[model samples]
Target chain A: MTADVRDVWTYLADTPLLGLTATLIAWDAASWIWRRARMTPLLNPVLLAIVMIVIFLSATGIDYRRYFAGAQFIHFLLGPATVALAIPLYRQIHALRRSALAVTIALAFGSVTAAASAVGIAWALGASRSTILSLAPKSATTPIAMGIAKEIGGLPSLTAVLVLLTGIVGATMGPWLLAKLKVADPRAQGLALGVASHGIGTARALQSGEVAGAFSGLAMGLNGLATAILVPLLVRWLLN
Target chain B: MLSYITVLLGCQLAGETIVRLLGIPIPGPVVGMVVLFLLLAIRGGVPEGLDKVGRALLLNLSLLFVPAGVGVMVYLQRIAKEWLPISAALVIGTLITIAVTGLAMSALVKGRRQ
Candidate 1:
């Protein structure tokens, strides 16, 4: 039985189907659990699915590169999805116009604060420079964060993982924390979540309402742009 | 759907070109997004087909990250070695970021109200 199962696994793994199928299955299973949990923020479907897939791959001894070959299909959606953010932003033109200046200010302040504090904390904790650089872009969306990390001497792969963790944490705890802070405005809530967490937090913000989702998308994009420009200059000035 | 996608990819390509030409460090897609947003604002509305396609993409946005997130497996050794600082920075930094951005924006937004 063991030998037969091993043969079956090898056949599947040899094709491009394994990673693609595993990702869908893992997310489907995660969504099931998330639904079972009544969509609790703590069981964020992305985080749950990542944990599930990581464990399966580790247990099966499938190389991460091999799995990524198939999984990259879904990954292609990020570009289009990011571009798609324009739709929601377009939809919220009236409200966005009202809060435009405020959003800009918040994004600038928030972006600098998040990156500086993370780099500062990591530096104080004795993390290596590479690790600190990797941590600096954690609040931006994954691609931008990875790109900035590479430009700044950080390992892109390490930054990728840190970015995911940052997003997951932001999505999970943001709303609860905001409520505690008496932050009642959706624009502020969504903008904060986006600046701090990027796409994953924007996903969570979408669940709140169109207004929040729109602003979150705005913040996510603006923060990505800001972080790209700001982190390097800040690092040069402050760290050097 | 296809034309709408083309427009998006086209903008992304333009963004990449602009970034490379100008030596800007931001990701291509983000500039792609800004370009698309500006075009739509000038047009005064999202086209129905593009709106539908874009909405579908955003609705399922989280799925796109799973592949990258799986790369965590490759860093198990590093994570194991530095879990303390890594975890501390993530949790503490995230909370502070959320608090600062939210409060600062709220304060500014409220200032606008008064």
Candidate 2:
């Protein structure tokens, strides 16, 4: 019986199924808890899932690389899902056009502020140069942020983690902060979330309403562009 | 659903090709989003099947980040070394960015209306 159980473990480890199953199970369990907890932002499903998976991997003596070998299947879908952002964006095309100028101004400021503030605070707090660079693009989506971090002399992997943390922070605290500030407009609120948090914030915005979701999507995309352009320039001026 | 997936992946492929060719700084998927948006605009309507697929994908969007988020464990040592600065910057910077952007956008929109 012991030999058979070890054999089964070895077989599962050799394939992607274990990693895939773990990811799904962790997310489902996290989501269930989130829902049961009254959907509080404090209990963010993604954050919960990550914590659970990390604990699981650590306990099992499994490394992230092995887990990612299976999780990559889900990760690859991020690309197509990003492309699908067009659907909600298209649904709100008219509204987008109507607020083009407002979006442009808001995005310009938000993008610059997002990168600058993160970098500034980190620098003042005595983080290293590469760390500062990685944190600079935290507001952009993961792929774009990772790319920018590489271009600007930072660890891409570290940047990816910072971007994730930024998203969680933004998604969890952003709506409440906005409400406190009396930024009651859905478009504005969504745009802020996207600019500050990227896709995760956009996910939170989607729960608010379609209008907020659409604008959040728009803000996320534009913030990527603006941050990509601005961060390099800011790096040159601030770092060099 | 398959066709919708095809269109999305195709656009992303084209976008990746374009970015590589032009050395564009933006990610390919974002450009693919633009291409998809344009295509939908030209068609003047979203097909029901495509809409369903898109919604399903977006609905589960947060789940997609799970893999990457879990990968944070790999950087545990680096993060632990800079935990204070990192945490402060993430929390404070994000809140300030949200406030600045939200306030600016709302004010601008209201000004435009006036």
The model with the greatest DockQ is: 1
Score each candidate by Cα lDDT. Answer: 0.85, 0.86
In model 1, what are the clashing residue pairs, if there are any?
A: none
lDDT of 2 by residue, A19-135 (tens): 999999999999999999977666878789989999999997888898899999998888888788778767765667978889999999899889989999999999888889889
User: Deviation in angstroms for B112 in model 1?
Assistant: 3.0
Tens digit per residue, CA lDDT, model 1, B1-114: 899889888888888888889987666777788899999989988899998888788778777777887887787787788777788789889889999999999999899899
Q: How does residue A221 of candidate 1 score in lDDT?
A: 74
In candidate 2, which residue pairs clash? Answer: none
Give the CAPRI rating of model 1. medium
Off by more than 4 A, model 2 = A143-157, A179-186, A199-214, A236-240
lDDT, candidate 2, residue B28?
78
Give TM-scores of chain A for all candidates.
Answer: 0.83, 0.84
